[model samples]
Target: CLSSQHTEGNVGTKSEEKLIELIPLIISCSREKHIWKHIYVFLTPGLKWHSAGVVRPTLTVLPPSKEEDKQSSATVVCLATGGFPSNWKLGWTVGGTSTSSGVSTSLEVLGTDGRYSWSSTLSLSADQWRKAGSVSCEASLSGQSPVTQTLDPDHCSE
Candidate 1:
């Protein structure tokens, strides 16, 4: 069963009191066969609100690994961190064109501070990387502007 409660309090030294609702989320996990356990969780205060209070994610674009630079192909990674909720999506673009082939995205990882982090990787051939003008990583959420980070291949060091 799910229960909700409405509460009001002052947040961050503001004189006005904010109204927040507490919604219980129940998760079930099984440690062994036929053995099931349930855990009840509640979101932090600021996260209890709707999209108006959504936390934007910080994006970082990492250059190609040194080991991969020695090979025929190269890989770049994009990491998005400190976003609220787990519904954000990560996408990649190479030279201003959206590229999905040889791309991999990881599942959202929930942090103890009530935020989420995710990562995406893009793989390209050595020849392609050299000529590729710019690579971008964008994190998108519904009803919000996407956060994008761009990296120039020419600026990257071996």
Candidate 2:
């Protein structure tokens, strides 16, 4: 596997060496700042701040217990957290086929860390849960790739 490293450099510098690295950025920001503002004015209407980082969501699947399955059905909750912009989509799929029936989705909640969290529940029949197939939960954001978590029905035990 290939890995990468990131280094943070101080933007406010008093030394000439540090200043040399920032000269190009400083000059460009001075001239193009106005242009960028004009270009993004409509895009960021009434926005005070914007998050630059694209935080991928963390997904968790809560399988139903055996007792709960006795009612001929199971309830599985998919939790998605630590995402940004509060505009995410959560979905459920069984064996790669999407399902909307018997699904309830919650609204996005903002956390103290400025990220967002959301959850969705899928209600499946006990037979569906016992089919030994895969159930997947997917989370996605506009202009970004989707993140998914899967659970095997065969692995769910009493």
Off by over 4 Å in 2: 1-50
lDDT of 1 by residue, 2-113 (tens): 2223223421221134333223433224434544322223344344432223678999999887788788788999999998657889999999999999999999886646
Residue 14 of model 2 has an lDDT of: 40
**Model 1 poorest ten-residue lDDT run:** 6-15
Show the colliding residue pairs in model 1. Answer: none
User: How far is 22's C-alpha from truth in model 2 (Å)?
Assistant: 29
Considering every candidate listed, which one attains the maximal TM-score?
1
> For each candidate, what TM-score against the reference?
0.69, 0.68
Q: Mind giving the per-residue lDDT tens digits that candidate 2 earns over 1-158?
A: 11112112332334433221101111122453543211010012222222234578899999988887888988889999988657789999987899888899999986655567999999988988888398999998777889999999888776
Candidate 2 clashing pairs, residues 3+ apart or interchain? none
